[model samples]
Target: MKQDVQPLIVNVKRYTLVRNLVFGWLTVVLFAGFLLNFPKINILEHTARNLYFHVPMWFTMMAAAFVSGYHSLKVLQTGDPLRDIRALQAARIGTFFGILGLSTGIVWSRFTWYVGTDVWWNFDPRQIMVSIQLLIYGGYFVLRSAFDEPNRRAKISAVFNLFAMTALPFLLYVIPRQMESLHPGAEGNPAFSQITHPVMRLVFYPAIIGFIGLFWVLYTQRVRVAWLKYRVTQDSEM
Candidate 1:
């Protein structure tokens, strides 16, 4: 029973934009106007509004991390060097999305938590710790570049990435629940139920799909660029 439904879901997700383009665009246009017409729908009104950007950022990061882990596992099994490159590329994508997530979150937090303050950042527990998560990836990239040997770089990086899952338990699971956050919601707690009107739900869901698709397209392009650069470097070395 499970096997029968799995492929169906996979196929639909794979062709989301293709199957729903007309509806997707209509939703896009509607959400665009809805957000504009009702400025109060934004994070300015409440942290619920941050869902448009913040949730997508986290989604993108998870997508990137999934790619990274898949490639890492392949490299582990097949000893393929290209898989390592792919994993690195995916990790880089995650890093980019992670930084954006932090920045957008700070913007949302500033008005909600630290109103009238000259400086925007604060030591909010979740905020401080997410920054640490960001730094962990940053350190991964730095370590990747710092190593002179390719095999050594790939091995060390793959090992380092395994530890990232450790932070997830803390950052994603604990801090949001334990601390008194200025951010509206906690891990399991309901922040605001008021924002989930039918109009918002209709537009917001499609907007999320569109944004994620947009990020995937960019990721593919970046992978292509990295492959081309690798080819050039290989040709020159030969």
Candidate 2:
């Protein structure tokens, strides 16, 4: 007789520690984002404070993207349903954060980069490329839904997930830098570091850490729920 191995959803004590720490850290980050004084820049003014929220979201999304990709790779190698669950949930949450980043970036740009103009959708390279990258992730989800069988679905979606993950860096960084864009580090624009003040960096760096921590907490919870659902249904769609 063959022995069945159980999946570890999460380590309860460690998960609790991480979840609480992320919540506390994010509370500080959000509070300090608005309360602390930021150096006002030309056309940015107080909106510069959005740096703590907006930029960190992209970092979180990027972290989630690579995480999703890594799990998807494992799914292909081991054919584990748990890895599939993680890959799907990570991409879903990552896409959610990516949308938030894009939306926040749009709001930030309107006030600073495109002041007094009615052009809200001017096809900025950074914006368009990010949108395309998100759509590719969208395709990954839809591809999962197309297959009724769990094993087949997991395998096929893992392949698609890998592709989506592989494309993320190019879409977010490489291609955007090559074109003229409203965002930093594009077409002769100054680098973010050179332009940023040290005082602002204090919060900026921590904000990235906090948001990435938040992503993990959320992803872990979702994985746990998916594990439960899989126990009941033997399917990992949720």
Candidate 3:
């Protein structure tokens, strides 16, 4: 059977509308994040604004990881090349967002909890686990490169993607909360809900929506490009 490209092609007009909406929505989120008056916590006063970007980025990465895994599962079920393309691109974009989240977190922690101390990485459990999670995803991409046959690469990569996705919850959330850490909701710690104002949720929720939207637009564009490249080159590795 011929592998049809119909499922891989995105609707141009729909893509444009969503792309524009994400752009506008995130623009508002950017301005509002900086401009809005947040209730002051003694230590976190101004840097609390990092909440809008940092937390939502992890949300986006989590969203992207699942999206990738879902497609990877489909790839396993049906052996669709398009699904493999999507899985790879989603993981790529998700990894980028994860890096941003991690970097922003380091900065956020330095100025707040580690202030006046030279500690950049204090082995916070969440931080360490999340870092390990990213490295696992990194191994997925490396695993993909090991095979030249498209079908073999797709199947193997799908398996690895599922593994990484499975690890995410434990590494990012469950294990972190079980350990002593600087993060909110750690063992014997106050969760964000207990520490911060309800007002922050107004921006927080929308920021999640906006960043996830941004991830979708970027993911769609990459899938389209990879589809085209596969058509021309008979390879979907991009």
Candidate 4:
């Protein structure tokens, strides 16, 4: 009994520590993101400030994909229900970040690039690819719900999750760059490093770390809640 309780206590303590640390770290990133001075450029003027926020959303999504993929792989090997919970939570958070990224990109583009045209989405290659990527993950959730059995759902969804993860890099980064895009890093367009200022990098790097930390905190919190529900109801679907 003591041995079992000891692991729970340790997990509680570690979760508390990470929770507090991420909260404080993100607070700093928020302030630094706004306070840091950046060089001004035409059309992108103040919107350039979004570099600290908008870009990190995709980065966090990528991190979440990798985490979800790892857990899916474990579920295949160990057939652990807990691993399914982790994978589901991670994918959910990743989708959330992707939505945020798309929304922010729309807002940024409307204000800066499409000011007169009233166009919210220009069907940019990167934009289209990211939308497709989100749809793929959406299918993962749908696939999970198609099954009534816990073990069966976990097994099938884990396979689909792996395929989704495999397509993420290609959709989000590779194919986007090969096509014509308003976004940076497209064919003939300057990469981020070429256009970003040194001062912005200071905040940009920390912002990525902070947002990924935020993802972890949220993901872990969901896992704990799902695990508790599983224990009480004997239903892993929660």
- Candidate 4 is scored at a TM of 0.96
lDDT per residue for candidate 3 within 1-238, as digits (tens), equals 3555565378777999999999999999999888989767788888888889999999999999999999999999999999999999999999999999999999999888998999999999988998999999899999999999999999989999999999998899999999999889999999889987887778888999999999999999999999999989999998
As a TM-score, model 2 comes out at: 0.95
Q: How do the residues 41-114 of candidate 4 rate in per-residue lDDT, one tens digit apiece?
A: 88888788898899999999999999999999999999999899999999999999999999999999999889
Span of ten consecutive residues with least summed lDDT in model 2: 1-10
Q: Rate the local accuracy (lDDT) of all candidates.
A: 0.65, 0.90, 0.93, 0.91
Score residue 93 of candidate 1 by CA lDDT.
76
Native-to-model Cα distance after best TM-score fit, residue 203 in candidate 1, in Å: 3.2
Clashing pairs in 3: none
lDDT of 2 by residue, 1-238 (tens): 2333863668787999999999999999888888888666887888888889999989999999999999999999999988999999999899989999999988888777788896677799989999999999999989999999999999999999999989999999999999998777998988798888888988899999999999999889998999899989898987
The numbered model that scores best in lDDT is 3
Total clashing pairs for each candidate? 0, 0, 0, 0
Question: How does each model score on TM-score?
Answer: 0.74, 0.95, 0.96, 0.96
